[model samples]
Structures are given as C-alpha cells and as structure tokens.
Target chain A: MFLIKHEVQVLDAKLDKLHHDIMTHQENILILTAEWSYLNQPGRIESLARRHSDYRPTETKQIINIENLPYPKKTSLVRGRIDGD
Target chain B: MVIKFDGLKSQKSIQLDGSVNKAIEGGRNRLLVLSCVFCLAFVAAGVRLLDVSVLRGLQEPIDVVEPTKENLKIGRAEILDRNGILLATSLSVSSLYADPQEVMDINSTVEDLSTVLVNLEKEKLFKKLNQKKRFVWIKRGITPMQQAQINALGLPGLHFQKEDRRFYPQRNLSAHVVGFSGVDAAGLAGVEKQFDGRLRDGSEPMTLSIDIRIQHILREEIKKQIINFNAIGGAGVFIDVDTGEILGMVSLPDFDPNVLNSASADTKFNRATLGVYEMGSTFKIFNTALALEAGTATMESGYDATRPIRIARFTINDFHPQKRWLSVPEIFQYSSNIGSAKMALDFGPKAQKKFMKKLGFLDRLPVELPEKGKPMYPAPWKKISTITISYGHGIAISPLHLVSGVASVINGGIRWPVTILKKNSQSKMFGEQILSLQTSKDIRKMLRLVVENGTGKNAAAAGYMVGGKTGTADKQSPTGSYAKSSRLSSFVGAFPIHKPKYAVLVMVDEPKGNKKSFGYATGGWVAAPAVRQIIKRSAPLLGLLPVDEVSPQIRRLLEIKTPQQKRGNQLASF
Candidate 1:
C-alpha cells in the first residue's frame, strides 16, 4: 500500500511537470511566431536585399514558359554507370 | 457532619440564631447546584471530544474539476492576406506590476526590478513604491528574457499580468484595410470591425482576398504618381472582374495602423471606398452601354455633333471637338460631350434612371468597409440632368462604384457585388445581369480601341490588349461653380481585354503638372500612366500572360468594322 501511494505521488508530480513544459512551449511558440512574421515582412526583406545585392523587380520575360511549368523541359545526366546500370 | 458543624459554629458566632443555620443550609444547597451544573458541562465536553476523536473516519481528497487554462485565451484571431502572409496577429505578453504593501524591502525590490527592466528609472520606481495604493504598474509588454530574469530574482511584491497585444507585422502596408484593435483587443475599424464577432471567437485565422504582392505594386505606383505629379492625394483599386474580389485597394495618405493613435483623420480616410466625385467622361461608358442596350443606337448609327448644344445656361461642348458627324464608335473613342448628351436625350431621363439603378449607382456601395458614400444624383431627374449625367456630371459616385460598374459591363454583363473576401474560383457565380451579352462585348471593343488609338494609349500595360477610359472633372467649388484650377483626373481599365479578367482604377486629386507632363493635369497625362505602370508590374505576378496582338484569334477578337455607307463614312485625312 505504501509503495502504491508513493508511485501515485510520483506520477502526479510527473504529470504536473509535463503540463508546465507544454504551457511554456506553447507560449514560446507564440512569441517566436510573432517575431518570425515581423522579420519576414516583405518591405523589410525587399529593402535588405536591395541594399545587399543588385536585384530588380521581376518582369514578364523572367517568368518561365507556362507549358514547361511544374517541371522543366530537360534534365541532363552524365553518361556514367552505376553498379545496377 | 464535621462540615455542617463548622458552618453552624461560624453562623452561631455571627448571629446566635436558628436563622443563621438556615441561611448556611441555603448557601450549601446553592453551591451544590452550581457544582452539579459544572460537572454536567464537563461530562458533555468529554463525550463530544471522544465522539469526534474516536468515531471520525479517514479523510478524502477533494476533486479538481477545472480544465487547464493555458490553451483558453480570449485573444483576437490572426488576419492573413490571401497568400497567408500575417497582416495582423495577437501576441500574449507579460506586464509587470507591484504590490506596495507586500514589499518586504522596497529598496531591494526596486533594485531587483531595475536589474531586469533596464529602462525603468529608479526615481520613478521609488515614487511608485512609496505610494499608499496597493498596486501599481511597473512596466507592460516585457520580453520573455526579461520576464525570466525577473522570475529568477524571486521578488515577493512584483507580479506579471498576462495580457494580449495586437501586432501588425505588415505595419502600414495594409493599414486602411486590416484595421487596428484597441489595447483590450477590441477591433476598431475596417475589416477588423466588419468581422468582429467571428474574430472575437478566435477559433481560426481569417484570410482576406487582398494579395500583398499586388497591393505593394499598386501602392508603389500610386505613390510614385502622387509624388511625380505633385498631387494633393490619390486613390487606386484593382479587382478580379469576374469574381468582384478586390485584389488590391490603396488610398494614399494612408495611416500606419500599428501606431494608430498617431494617424490623423485625413490620413485615415479610405478615399477609394468613401470619397465620391462627378466622374467626368467615364460615365460615357454607361451612356453608350445604355444606348446600345435600349436600341437607341447601333454600331453604324450616326449622330451630328457638328456644333455644341446650348440649353439652360449650359453649353455642352467636346474637349477636343471634331465639329462633324461621328459614328457610335467614334463618339465613344473621342469621348465627345455633345455626342453623349445627344445619345442620352434619345433614351430620356426615366430610362437612364432605371439603367443607373440596375447598375448599383442608386445605392451605397455594398463593400465590406463601413466607410461608404451614397451617390448623389438629381432627385427631379430633369432633361438637363440627363444630358450632363450622360457625359459624367450632375451625379457623384465613389471610385469603387465606377470600378465595379466597369467590371460588370466587361464581365459578360454579370453584376457581381464587390467583396473583400475571397470567392472560390471554382464555385459557380450567381449575379444580376445588368446588360445584354452583346452590349458587353461591344463596350469591350470600344474600351480596347480607346487604349489602341484614343486617349488611353498610356494604359497599354503588361498586356497589349489593355482596355480603358479616362475622366478629368473640374472640382466643384463650395459656391456651386466649377473650379478650373482643381480637377479630379482618373483612369479605369481592364487587361486581357478580349476575355476581360481584371479592372483597375487610378485617381489623382488636384495634381499640378510638371516639366515631364508639359503643364497638363488631365487623366491621359496624369492618372493613365500610373494605371499602366501598376498593371504592367502586377500582371506577371498575377499569372496573366502577355497576349499576342497579331495572332489570328486575337486580331479577329478585337477587329472593328468601319460603317460602309457614305453617310457613315469617315472624314478624309489631311
């Protein structure tokens, strides 16, 4: 009986620790998500890229052909052999 | 016997009478009664003690029925653009406060708090701690690291109050649309107020039809025009013509909703939805559509516009008069005021009212924004009103109304009400039919011709088949006179015109001409180029391919016929 009560108390303590960890993790996720979105705002990214690199806005010519979309027209391979081949 | 004898001896010595012995006996009986009462009380106490101590059973634990509260927050749900970019989000933050009475050592407590919250001044903390009040706010919106440090200090009096604060990740990029919330997480304006109940439920995030990429392009173009032309203000909106889903809407002098308290009333005004103007020649689009739908005019019909008409102290004259007869298509292409007025008079006022009513010009715009303008039209509906209204005067409608009206006319005559929520492209569309399919096709041709050869050439954008109309109205003075110096110049159009998919509008208020424009502030010079720039940049992003104008299918689709009869023949070139 004593052993059973001790086991129950230990399990209760473990459950409380797990619940506390979950709550802490959820709060952390919320804060991190808000920060992630703030950092990923388009204007900030665009300005940073412009300052660091020579990038221009996309034009019609830059977009690939619609027919070849979802997969490019060609994939090349060197004429080398694998053991199975 | 010995006690009684002693009492008797004491009584005999004091009184020497039988009465003394009787008195002694009475006293003894009284003492005995008091002792019996005391003994009964003691016996009752002893029995209760034994009953409680020996008969009571083992103790049992009370059950806790309350569910965990960490997942249950009363915060507003997130708002995202159509592509899932977070526009507005609710974040849980910690607010530090102190109980002055609970502080064991005020100096030490203040010192400990200042270590974690570096920005807090020591003097202010001392003043707050010295106050007789029970509670005071130390700081609000503390970061997690600061919270952890404060917790590590294990201060007795300090506490953290958990609160939810709204954060606009996009900042001012989509301010006028996704509005701000107050400190208590109550929505205040725009879409926030429009869907307050759903947002307050906070079950899931809501998505708006606004595409941030297109919104950025549209705002940038309008901003550029406002700066380059030195305009007082500008407004622009672009929509999916078929679905009536607003892809992007921008009203310049917009506010940063994040810092909403700093935004003034002028900057917060959503001009695109609320500001109404007498939309000069653009109303001619409707007049032409009305004439064709009512059988009052045809493709080959001719109107004699050799001279301006003068009636009721008003002269109806074209801006660039040809002073000769023009075909139905010519009146539309040249945007002749005399020709449009004549065409309007043929159908009369009653028919025009019915037509306008069907096109939603008679009511407030049915958009989701609370800021809306009711159109101003002449209540009496006179012949003069009809004539002026035909050429886009004597009636004031919002820019949103004109854009959606153009959309309905171009989208095979289906009048879909403008919406800010995304309409599933695969869902079957049901809308009111305001015009015949034939009239719609004919108007599409006229719009394309305007871009190709007429006043809207600047609107040829990401596609060759862009179709549009331009409007330049003299702003009315307070004393009911036209002010020539101030004009409302605007351009509205659709791209991929043959199978029209998108409609856009750019309006510039009181733009002063610059060296680049050669001192002209008309729509052709001011607002049309902005439309072209916007559509050209945004079209590739929107997945609209550049149409090949010379292709046989394209040529056949946009080909216009010249009236063969001598009466309808074109004027000879110089």
Candidate 2:
C-alpha cells in the first residue's frame, strides 16, 4: 500500500506538468495564428510580389476560352503513331 | 480475620468486593466500545480516499481546466472573407495595470512605464498610480515588447492582465463591412454590430460574403476614378445576381477599422447602402420593366417625345432629347424623360408605387450594415411626382436598392435579398418572384441595347456581355433645388446577359468635367468606365470564362437594329 501511494503521487505530479505544458503550447499557437494572419494580408502580399518578382495579376481579357485555342497540329506529333506507343 | 468476623462484617466485605468487580466490568465495556468505533472510522476514511484517488481515476480525466476566464475570453469571433481570408480577429494581449494601493515610489514607476510606453503620458500614469483606488489601467493594448520590458522592470504593484483586442488584419480593405470594435470589445458598427450577439457567444470565425481580391480590385478602380475626376467620394457594389451575395462593396474615404475613433463622419459613411440620392435614369429600368409587366406597354408601343411636358411647376424633358414618336425601347435607349413620363401616366401612379415598393425602394434596404438609408419619396402620389420619378428625380434611394432591384429584374425575376455573409451554395435561394419571366427577358434585352449602342456604351467589356443603364442626376441642394454643377453620376450593370451572374453599381459624387471626356462629367464618361475597369480586373479572378460574343445565340440577343434596316424594310414592302 505504501509503495502504491508513492507511485500515485509521482503520476499526479507528471499529469500536472503535462497539463501545464499543453496550456502553454495552446497559448503560443493562438499568438502565432494571429501573427500569421497579420503577415498574410492581401495588400501586403500584392506589394511584396510587385517589389520582389516579375509576376503580375492576370487580366480577364488575357484569359482565352478553351474553344478559342487552335487545334493541335497532327504533323507536330510523329505522323504515324503516338510517341509513347 | 474471616474467622473472627461477625455476620455484618462478612456482608460489608462481600459488598465491597462486588462493587470493585462492577467498576472493573464497566471500565472494560467502555474500552471495547471505543476501539470498535475507532476501527470503523479508520475503515471509512480509507474507503473514501481510495474512492477519490483510484475509483474516480478509472474515469476519463477532466478536460483541461480551460484557462481562467480572463485568458479564455476570445473577445468576439474572427471575421473572414468568403475565401477564408482573415478580415477581423481578436488577439490576446497583455494589458498593463497598476494596483494603486500597493504601488510604492509612484514617481519612479510612472517614469519607467512611460519610458517603455512612449505613447502614454507620464503625468497621467503618475496620477493613476497615486490614486487610492485598488486597481487602475496603465495601458489597455500594450505590445509584447512593452509587456516584456515592463516585466523586466519588475516594479511592485504593476501587473499584467490578459485581454482580447480586436484587430483588423486587412486594415481598411474591408473596413465598412468588418467594422471595428469598442474598448471593451463590443461591436459598434457594420457587420460587427449586425452579428454582435453571435460573434460574442461563439468562437468560430464568422465568414462574410466579400472576396478580398475583388474588394481590392473594386476599391483600387474606384479610388483611381475618384482621383482622376477629382470627385468628392465614390461607392461601388458587386453582387452575385443569382444568389444576391454581395461579393464586394467599396465606399471611398474609408477608414481603418483598427483606428475607428479618429475617423470622421464622412469617412465612416457607407455611401453604397447608407447615402440616398435621386438615382436619375436608373429608375427608368424599373419604370420600363413595370410598364411591360402591367401589360400597358410593349417593346413596340410608341409615346410622343416631341417636346417637354409642362405640368404645374415642372417641365419633364430628356438630357439626350429625341423629339419624335419614340417606341418603348427607343424611349429607354434615349433615356427620354418626356416619353417615360407619358408611359408612366399611361401605366398610372398606383401601379408605379406598388412596383417601386416591390423593388424595395420605399423602405430601408435590409442589408447587414447598421447604416441603412431610408428611401425618400413624395408622400402623396401626385401627377408631377410620377413624371419626375419616372426618370429617377423625385424619388430617392440608395445605390444598394438600385443594384438589388436590378438584380431581381435581370436574374430571372427572383428578388433575392442582398447578403454580406457567405451563404452555402447548396442552400435554397430566398426571394419572391416580383416580375414575370418573360418581362425580365425583355428588360434584359433593352439593357443590352443600352450597353451595345446607347448611353452605357463605355461600360461594355469585350466578351462579358455587359448590359446596364447610365444615370446622371443633379444633386439636390440644401435649399431643395437641383444644383447644376453637382451631378451624382452612377451606372448599374449586369454581365453575361443571357445568363446573368453578377450585378455591379458604381456611383460618383460631384465629379468634375475633364478634358479627356470632352468636358462631360456624365455617368457614361465617369461611372461607366469605372465599372468596366472593375469588371475587367475582377472577372478572371472570379473564374468567369470569357464567352464567344460572335456566337449566333449571343449575337441574336445583343444585336442592335439600325434605323437604316427599318428604312430598307419599308422600301422593300413598297
């Protein structure tokens, strides 16, 4: 009985430590999520993209419908058969 | 001694021995009872301790004792755009407070705090620290750096309290929609105020119907126009015609929701839904649609537009006057106020009032914003009122009302209420059928005509099949007369006319005439081009495929017949 009581005491202490660790981790996660959102604001990203890279937003008129695309050339492919086959 | 004892002595000795025996027996009984009671108490205590530690432990552990109430106060749920982009959120921050009664050396504490919190006044902090009160706030929303610095100071009586501070991640991008909160984290305006109770009670993020990308595009275009025209202000709204979900609503001179306290009344004003104006010829869409719905007029019905009609104190005329007999379609295409009034007179006032009411022009728009404008119309229906209102002069309504009503007319007659919250695509649409399906088709045709060849030509986007009307109304002065120089130029339009999907409205307040636009600050020159730019920039982002405008179906729907065709047909008949 004495041994069992000692073991219980040790387990209770470990459980308490785990709970505290979990709470601390949760608080950290909350703070980080807020920081993530702040960093990912659309305006911030757009300005960054403009400054750092050559990429720009695609204009609607620039996008062509599939039907508007020219048909693939049969001669561009090996005339007799499919390449893989 | 026994041998010599008399009878009385022998009796006394025996009695004394018996009494001693009785005393010993009583003492023994009391000791036995005491031991049993002690043993029972020990057993009971052992059982209780075992039950608590072992038996109860067999059950699942209690959920992590949620952080204390202060740490768990997720102030209000975060607000996200339709694409789950964060617009408004609450960050848990540490607020610095002082227990004034426990504070020692108030001057030194104040100096240390003020040094760390540069925005705080040292005198005020000193005063707060010296108060007899138990607790006083030093700063409510301190940065983490400030919190750490204050902690390093380790000043007695100073403490940190965890609090939730509302943060707008997108800043002024969607300010008027995801409004700011007060010091106590209570919503004060916009969607924050609209869904205050739900936001406070739940921790899940509230998703709005706004798309951040579209919102940025619309605001950028509107801002550009406002600067180009040197206009006082501008507003724009884009609504999904089928579902009535407001994709983006932009009001210029918008303020950052994070710093709402310093925003002026003009900056906070939501012009799209809250600023009512005489919406000029846009009302003609309603007049023409109503005229068709009532069976009093057809596309070919002609009205005399030879001259302006003089009634009482008003002369009803058109900005682009066509002095001839104009067909119903011609009347709308030319925006002839004289012909529209004659049509309205033929349709009668009661029907017009009922149609306006059905279009939600006689009451406040039921959008989620706390700032909604009540429509202004003449109380008693008069003859001249009908004439002026036919061309959108006497009756005043918000831009939101015009867009929502136009959405109903073009979106197959269903009048869906405008919503700012993201709606489930699978959810059933909610609206009443206010116009016949046939009449709606006819109206769509007429609107397409305007965009194809008439006033709204500037608003046309290639392959988008933009159909809309242009409205240029004189701003009503404080003295109740129309100001000549101040024009409220606006354009309301829908795209992919055969199957309308989106309705957009752009209104510019007091735009100045510029040299590029031939010194004409009309809706066609100002607001129409803004709408065209918005649609062009937003369509690809919205994943709308550009259709073939030359296809027979689209061509037949949007084609405008020339007057030469009419003359040729007449000659052929002869």
Candidate achieving the largest TM-score: 2
lDDT of 1: 0.84
> Which pairs clash in the backbone of model 1?
none
lDDT of 1 by residue, B21-125 (tens): 788899999999999999999999989877755555144344634345535443788888888888888888889898999888988998878777877899988
- Cα lDDT tens digits for candidate 2, B302-342: 88999989999877777876677888877777778898999
TM-score of 2: 0.88
* Clash pairs detected, candidate 2: none
Clashes of 1: 0
Which window of 10 residues has the lowest lDDT sum in candidate 1 chain B? B565-574
Question: What does the lDDT read for residue B34 in candidate 1?
Answer: 99
What does TM-score give for chain A of every model?
Answer: 0.69, 0.81
